[model samples]
Target: MTFNIAFSEVTVTIGNVSVDGYTEDIVVPITVSNPNESVGGFQFDVITMPTIINISDVSSVNENDFSADFNIFDDGTARVVFYSNTGEGIPAGSDEVVLNLHYNGMDVLSALVDLEGFNLTVSDADGDVIAGNIVDGSVTIGNVVFFSSDIPDTGDVLEQVSVDISIQNSGLVGGVQFDMYDTPNYLDVINLTTTTRTEGFQIDFNELDNGATRVLLYSPDNQNIASGSGPIANMEMVVHDNAYNSNVGVNFENITITDDIGGSYWVAGVDSGTVTVTPGYIEEPHNLQAQDGMDAQVLLSWDPPYGPIPSDFSEDFEEGVLPEDWITTTNSAQGWFITQDGSSAFWTVPSHTWYMCSNDDMADDDGSVDYLITPGLNVSGAQNITLNFASYYDGAYGQTAHVLVSTDGVNFTEVVTLEPSPEWVMETVDLSEFAGLPNLHVVFHSNDNGAWASGWAVDDVFITFAAREIDRLVHYELTELGQWALTAPKDEVMSRFGGGLPHNLKVDLSQPFLTENRPVELDAFKVYRSLNSSTGFQEIAEVGANTTSYLDEDVVNSTTYYYYVTAIYPDGSESGPTGTVSATPVEW
Candidate 1:
């Protein structure tokens, strides 16, 4: 003989909860559901991560009909038992709260609240067991501590560097402590100071033997850093002399954050900063020369040390087709196309033999959007970048053209919005803000907002980096013999006209140049002279930084002298001697 019994299907679920920070009491309902109205008693255990949350108390939903008893454990568990005190079973219902579990957030984290499978029980009025299903819940707490990203600064060897330390806190912060480490042998931490966000906080730090800096910040008056995001502290360090041409990193470890009540919070993330150290020595000077002057002088001039300004990237679209690396996207029938012939009367084509054009007149007018993007360019080493292109656009019927930039392929930012023009015009856009980006991309965007209009044409696109300015003497002329004779006596002029009269040399310098790279300050120009072309050069005179010419009035007529010039820095550093030039002083 065999007997079969069917149990009612009852589901007991724990509800999810989320809070911004630590809370004294958070209520979570334990709901029950069944098709049969025979639930008389229930028992279960709620378990959570001990480090994230703790169960505080439990209560019965129907106090008059049922009585509840709960036991809290130190390991973040609560055992609850509910019984029908009036001998009346709970009515059949969907998602009815049978028990309320209270919890206290322990840290900034997320944890699962699970029902103990082996300890769960659901019984009917007569104490018969019923089939049960369990559903778990979760709790999340929010507070984040991190360093600012891309904190980049350029410096020479043995220079001091500073970087910001930022945070995002959901709750007030009363204190913080962390250990900062730098790239071994590259940087040494000095100290830290409070920023505007932590103006009145007390700060202290100690340099450890292992090249790590341990820092602590707190408030003596129980003041709290308001919950928000910004820099809280600034760290100062010095780059080692051997760190030249290197990108040194500063990182954080062993971080701890505390609230006003002395409870510790979890650190969400951390980021490092990079210090780029440039070479310390100056480059060699260029374009040195000595020019002959009337009768008895040799004029010397030279250009400063400089790097050439060249286009880092350029495209003329003369290949008659789009390059394989470039990309195009469109939402309508027409998009960017390479063509030599201008077919639309409404569009003013560029004068290039081949160019890219987004013709709105040919595109479907249903809100056409088109984009032409360049390949990813590594411009991290470039300073003072710029974008230049030849463009033609005659707008009509709500059409628009824009030049955008992006570090990532997505999420472009408009750098230039083109105005309507009747003919081709050259456009230059300052891209200095994006100079240190590695994977930068340029976008040419066009849109016809649901109406037909003239389109945009572009050619000769270029991305360039500004070079260091090098001032040079471009022109030099010797004063005519008649000018020198104006002040000379007839007998003296007659004797010195062939070889012995004084010389006057006039030299002109090129216009003052500008650059965004590391530019050295000019203290003065040092002029040097040599009787031989290759050796025995001696410093003859020193002139101001703005000086362009030097007259060697001690020269003897008919004697050839070699000369070169160098730029001097305030730190007593002098550039390499410029190219030597030889000239002989002679009567005109």
Candidate 2:
């Protein structure tokens, strides 16, 4: 049997309200008709922003045949249910008052009070799904307000990006609802913070469909905002490295404001913004900081907190092809060529890619010097520069490899000289004395002076700043299962389960370093655990790279343990241990 349930009118007139000491009554009448059988029960939710209105009571008009109750949830939706009390039910074609909703004006706001009729139902004295058309109602509350913007038009990749949301001439507001949007694949929202008058209230943010995010802010005590301007919220986002040379769009949708006097305000228009991510050699300039110093101290450092360092620049040439920008020159026919060498067989230490130069590839040495120079590195404004690489040489005819640095790439300065070695030797050169230069060119010169030169092989070339402290936090908690879990992102409390427990420290290596769309690659991760806070830490386990988290299960009840993780690179370079985190296992 087909049954139709709908509101009596399109919009129940809620005329007007004063700003202070206001009280008003709003009645919403629900009707039912076209019933193929007797109607026994019905249910629906009155959805509206609580900051705008207060639902004091919801009683049925036909109390002789049915009784009703109203319940409100924290999300501001009121659920109303009415069921038949008498033995007989309302017959078909009977259209009378089924519900009388009572609302009090709490705020002067503007929005649609909706009757979500999806759960609306009618039964023939027996509980059954009734098939019919459920026409919902949309009731407008107040007047139209506006949402404005003052965001920048463009930004650079890896640059700090932020946007602001402002309310235009809004007064005595208690709550707001809006949708925020950004370039789907190019921009990532990292963090959001409240601003101005809204900072005094609580906010809820959730991700929506099609790369949109929703934000709702309301007074904790249901108080009204008297006056405010500027930004209401600040959103921090990042432009992906792959977005170089492209622009990302930012906009808002479905915005509304609610005053404390039971009135709602619709946003007149949404002001949009855009950010253009440009290509650059460096993500951003180093955040240099000054330190207190004594006489002739030169107390400049690249540590974090006060000073932060930039990501390293590295190249392995694993593709078996030299980068087009890399420089290669030779006074003779035989130059540096990437080839398989018996002396440089191992892949882990230096990398999978290696380059070699020797007289064996030429008919005669001719006392020629071959050069393999790297492309210009943008280490401008950087301090304490360093270079690391692996080389293998046989020392035939006293042939040596010379490492040189250049500012103009044409005029070279000899930095270090390497003797012949039968096995691969890792080298570290301190380029700190030459810091503060804009363009840095590193060159490897191999000399074969008309003599039998065995070979010169180099691999895993990397240029990085000095190691800095790792960021981390630790926590201890008692769980329901009575076991302690060591979480990377520190938390106050934790929960545990039976034997197969989860204790993975989730890591998000989502940001790119140099390669397009490719994240920084690590060979492995070493987790260190310590029982005594003042003593040494021992390696507990080692996991492979790209593994986001780790599970550490070994612990004794009532004992406290600390943990930290270090990333291992293919060139045998290890990152500084992350900040230590602690957890105590206790049975409750």
Candidate 3:
């Protein structure tokens, strides 16, 4: 007798799967059908179900009639029975009984396991793999068909060596997928997400963020597969998490990575490392200052605010201090003077020099006080021999306060005519008129009272010479997997992260100076200056950090000043007097 059952509609269907020797419910709504005669004892036989339940298991009967729940991660089994409602014996072509089964759930994924193994051989620049070179190495995605051209002798990812491994999913599981993970350093996905397009490799992952039991396949390249065996056909992926490798990393270890200098590695599955470079400690700006007592009792000193100034410095300059050559002048008469032209405040005394320029060289005439300095000057080239000072005018000496500047100094060029102030006033003169002259000289001449002009007070003299120098770049390599940054550059670079100056005491240099792949603390630095350099070099400034800059205003125009930043260790030892800052300081 043949049996066939059709249901008008499923009254109730329960589905289930087995795990750890027990049956668990996974799904529902199973229908039953019997077409053979009056045989009537049909029920679910959990013990009699076949061990393996795959898509092929539903071939003999309609899934609606004997459907059972299953875990995408678990291995399960199922069984089906037939019966007749009438007591009449077996009959052929019997077909009026409804067949249905009920199921609750499934667990296919928890029932599977995957494993991968990689065999590598390392080598030097030469393409020879050393023997027995196994250290720490691993592959991310598993289920490979292990293949290798040559076996590694040293276990290193030896040059031009081949490696292979077997890949397989233990069984059917929900959201479970497979692929090959290449060499540690060259470990790339081989399957395309959209298609099996093998341009780049594909990496599959479980989407923990999404509630759906979907397997995610990815490839670095945007290639489409013709067979369309991967992701949903043309399912627009909004975000592909290229950083998933970061989440469930696969990295390279001691194996020599291709295309990098010796010892370079992919390092524990990382795609790229964070390399930070920074200026050495000796490159910071140091204040350059100096003092000279020329022509007696005229205490003249000059200096600019320190270069690469410490972050602790405030913009408002609360310290009320200046760098080297920031000299304060005094007249034997204690004559008072203002900072910015006393009150006009509109004009700033840029540069100046003291001298005598008179209308007459008489014997019985009172001398006038005059000074010269450049005021409205703008330039963008190299220059030397600029002057800064204040002088008095003497009628007997034909204007003793007269000032002059020339490329040769001996060949003087008159700049501005000074209207001698009865008391004492300030003035400026710019030697920038000489354009690109590498040499400029400033001379102080006075015939006031026939070289006897008294009561003239000179104070607050300043000079600036620039010599710009270039610095090199240094890169830091990250040894381990994680995040890194310079603790100093953060607070030392005068950035928002350090709250501008006050917080920039440290330069976040990513160099592992003290400790390899780490950073070290450098002591203070000294700055050197050569005003004309004809006088060798003089000490200009000193700082307490690895400041790589220095600007000394005590330099003379046309004079080449060579400055060098030396790295001083905490033990008071110095490392570099190495290079100089070759800038001819110019205030434009």
- How do the residues 122-228 of candidate 2 rate in per-residue lDDT, one tens digit apiece? 55565554544455654445544567666765666677688787776445777888888875356777777887667577778888876688888887888665565
lDDT tens digits by residue: candidate 3, 1-588: 533333212111222222321124322223322232222223232321223223222121333332223222233433444332233322323343233323321332222111111132222112222222111111111111111112111111111221221112222111212222322222222222332333353544332332221324333443322321222211111112111111112221222211111111111222311111111122322222111111111111112112221221112111233322222222212222222111111111211222222222112243332222222222235453233333322121123344555443335566654554322232344554555555544433332433323222233333333322112111122222111121222222224423222101222223412211212345666665564433466666775553433334455544434444455555465654532333333221
Decreasing lDDT order of the candidates: 1, 2, 3
Better of 2 and 3 by TM-score: 2
Kindly provide the TM-score of model 3 when superposed on the true structure, using C-alpha atoms: 0.20
Off by over 4 Å in 3: 1-283, 291-522, 529-535, 538-588
What lDDT would candidate 1 get against the real structure?
Answer: 0.69
lDDT of all predictions: 0.69, 0.56, 0.28
Determine which window of 10 residues in candidate 3 has minimal summed lDDT: 291-300
Candidate 1 lDDT trough over 10 residues, lowest sum: 505-514
* Candidate 2 wrong stretches, greater than 4 Å: 1-24, 45-54, 62-66, 73-77, 84-88, 94-97, 112-118, 125-136, 145-248, 253-380, 383-441, 445-588
Of 2 and 3, the candidate ahead on lDDT is: 2
Model 1 stretches astray by more than 4 angstroms: 1-28, 33-41, 51-57, 72-76, 83-93, 102-164, 170-174, 181-195, 199-203, 209-212, 218-224, 234-588
